[model samples]
Structure formats: structure tokens, C-alpha cells
Target: MTAVEETQQAEAEDFLVDKAKAVEVEVPDAPEEIGRSDYYTAKEVSMHNKPSDVWVSFLGNVYDLTSVVSSQSRELESDGSSLVFPLIKCAGTDISHWFDETTGDIKKYVDPIKNMMTYYIPQGRFVHVPPAEPVSDWDNSFEVPWWKDATLKVGKLSASTRSLRVKNVLTGHEHLMEVPCEETVGQIRARYLEYNAHAASYTWKALKPNEEKELVFQNLDMTLNLQDNGIADDQPTFEALGISSDFHTPVIHLYYDDDLTVA
Candidate 1:
């Protein structure tokens, strides 16, 4: 090849190499998750572990909690101020295990902050993440960890899925009805009474599957929580009634009749 032609080819090759290098140096950002499938790997999440860019992996998701304590000053002397940073010490770490150790129902604490969170609303600070949709059902995915409070949801952590089912057995009926696990017996009975108007006046009885003996709907002794709900308007949950894990305990039987004799 001629020297001139060789020189031109070399320049073209160098140009291509520089372009490829530019693309290689670029860091791909995690997708913006707006309540859909935006996932991040654990290694990718670790990048933001520093205090200035704190992130947390929770419930199979990565959350950027940098915003939560960003404005806090260690020197400030607010009441119980010492506790603030400590609680969020897991800022850039996977807090799922810790969070689970703290509570089974995270929404109970998270939902309260939707309208207002005095702790994060510092003096003269207008920075606040807008509230997202509230989770109406217990089984809802809306309980996204990073979505709560000032934590900016960076991305979701991929994980396996889980589900639960509840069965409602009715008296004078031959079949059991499936219900959502989070539903209370009271909610199911009210619906049953609404549909079965004739049985409305009947006293209600909850029984174990295939067992003739009625399962006493004790006044609020059991719940899927750490604390007893204390005789909730309805009885304990079917899960709390020992119907959760065992199918052998099949059919949470519900009986309602104006007369015990009729039941």
C-alpha cells in the first residue's frame, strides 16, 4: 500500500477507536421506576452506599435514602436528635432484614407519613418528595419502601414473588369461598350477611375444617402483628385462626343463623 493511503486508514482506525472508547466509558443509569419493573443488581446498588449518596436495598428493591437525612446537621440540638441519624445508619445498606425485624406491616408506619412527616420537614426547607398513591389493600405492591417518606426510589431489587389466599366457609352452604389473605373474618361475614339476607340475624360461628366443634371467634386475641388488635370488630384472621400455613385446617367455616338450632 502507498504511504498516503496507509496514513488515511490509520486516521480512520484511530477515530473509530476513540468513538468506541467514549461509549465504553459511559455509565448506563438505572431505569426510572414509576411503579413498574425497574430493577437493579446488588452490586450496582452498592455504588451509592456513601453518605452523600446513600441507598438502601429493601424488600427486593434499591432505595436512594440520601434525601431523608441530607439536610440534617449533627450539631443541631433537636429533641431526640441523636436518634435521627442512628435510625438511618443503614442509609446505604440493605435494610430489608432490619426492616423486617422491626415490623411485619411496614405500611402501618409508612402510610402515616404520606400527608405529613414533621421529622423530614426541616425549618425553612421546602425540599420534599411528593406523595405517591396510597396503598388501599394489604397485598398491594404500593408498599414500596423507597416510595415512603423522603426516600427517593432509585430502583427495584429483583426478587421472587409471594402470595396468600383465604377461604371463607359458610353455614348451610356446601362450598368454601376463596378470599384475600389480608381480609378479616368480620369483613367476610359482613359480605356473607349482605348476600344471604335471610341469615343476617343469625349468630355467627367460626369453625375449623371438617371439625364439628365451632372455633371460638375470641375477642381480638390474634393478628399478623406484634401487638394484639384487641377484639377487633371481627374475630382474628383466618391465618391467625391457624388456617394460614396448613391446608389440613382447610375451610374457615362461618355459620350464621337466627337460631342456633337452624345452624
Candidate 2:
């Protein structure tokens, strides 16, 4: 070949070599395989030796692994055979605080002051239940009790009169009377019965001073006498009767001639 052609061929070969070096081939990531513990491998993950800060997703809710412990024995089924761990325990941080230095086992703290306000799943492990399909029907066809129609009226009284007016619109009854501006809630109950004789059997009481009662009054506007008692003045205008705030709302007991039974 001619000298010029040979030089050109040499340069082309060098160019091809540099081009191949410049091109990069990338390796794709392999598909992830499910781990043996992830499936039904019969291997149990023990929380006994785990750290107190480990979080566990149990029964669809995330829980502090250190707050609970497993007490009961559980069996693992693998390859048609059952493997039993009689004393295998899983403990969380809650159990960590009660750790016994002597036995190396967790101490049960049942009445934890800090956990009183929180919900706990107790120290036992539970099987997870799959979620079911939700029902879409939202219409309620059931009839409510007749006593639900009753309501109470609450309002504030003028300072000069020292009297408040409470009315039960359902029975067409009105109670207008004087009350001690500083009267306690207990005294208000007594006064309620004094002015309204019909209220004697109904047992009407203030849930909240100067506030509406859960009994669902037709008119919430009513005058309250602050001078009768100071007890209710500082409390919520609306309050529930009974020691527990979770009790059912107070309702007026009604009697029908046909049944004559208090409903």
C-alpha cells in the first residue's frame, strides 16, 4: 500500500481504539429475592436479644419493640413438621425497664404511670388478621328512641335578677326562678326541681354551667345567675353528669299511657 494510505489506516485504528474505551457498559441491578425469614420459613425473629429502640410492625401498627414481651409458647410449622419454642419470649422497651438483674428476664410493669395515657398491646404476641373489604353502605335505616327528641335550654341570667330560665321545649315547660349567683352545681339540681314540678321525675341537671347539655336542647340560649353559686361559674358552661366523662348523655325519662313503662 502507499505510505499515505498506510498512515491513514493507522490513524483510523487508533481512533477506533479510543472510541471503544470511551463507551461505558453498565450492569443492571439483579431482581431482589425474598428472604427466608420474610416468607413462611418457620424461623422466628426473637426480640429477647434485640435492642430497646427497635421498632416492629405488628398487626398493621408500628410498635416499640422494647415496650412489650411475648410470654406464651409458639410453634413454627416447616416442611410438615412442627418446631416448638416453649419459653421463647419477645420483649420490648416497656419490658426493658423492668429487667431483672438476677433472673435475666424482663419484669412485668403492669401499672406504668407513663403508659396510662397511651394504648398498649400488652405483653403477648398475637396472630395478624388480614383486613376485610369495607362495606360501602352508609345509609342508616334504624329508628332512634323517642326520648331522643327531648332537649334542654341553657342561658345566662341577668346580674340584678339573680335568676335563670331553663325550659324543656318538648314538654312546653318553662322554669323561671332565682338562683344564688355563687351556687354550686349540686344546688342547681335541687333548684331545677323546685321551680319545675314536672322536672322532679325527669331528674334534670346541669352538665355545664352556662353551656348546652348533651341532651340536645331546642334552644341553647338561657340566662345563668352567676351570683347563685361560684362553683359552676369557673367550670365549663356545659358539663356532663356522673363522675365519668364517658357516660351516656343524660336523657329525660318518658312514660307512655299505652305501656306506662319508663323508657
Candidate 2 lDDT, tens digit per residue, 1-263?
A: 99999999999999999999889555434322211111110011223235333333222122333322231123222332211121123322122322345543333344465443321234331222111223343222324211111111012211221335554645656655444443432344455645543332332333333444343322111232233322223222323332442232322222211211211
Q: What is the lDDT of residue 42 in candidate 2?
A: 9
Question: For model 1, how does the per-residue alpha-carbon lDDT over 11-90 read when each residue is reduced to its tens digit?
Answer: 99999999998877444343221221255555556677666777777766676766555644342222434323542555
Off by over 4 Å in 1: 1-37, 74-81, 100-147, 160-263
Could you estimate the TM-score for every candidate? Answer: 0.28, 0.19
Task: Count the clashes in each prediction.
Answer: 5, 36
Candidate closest to the true structure, highest TM-score: 1
Model 2 ranges with Cα > 4 A deviation: 1-161, 203-263
For all candidates in order, the CA lDDT equals: 0.43, 0.32
lDDT for 110 (candidate 2): 43
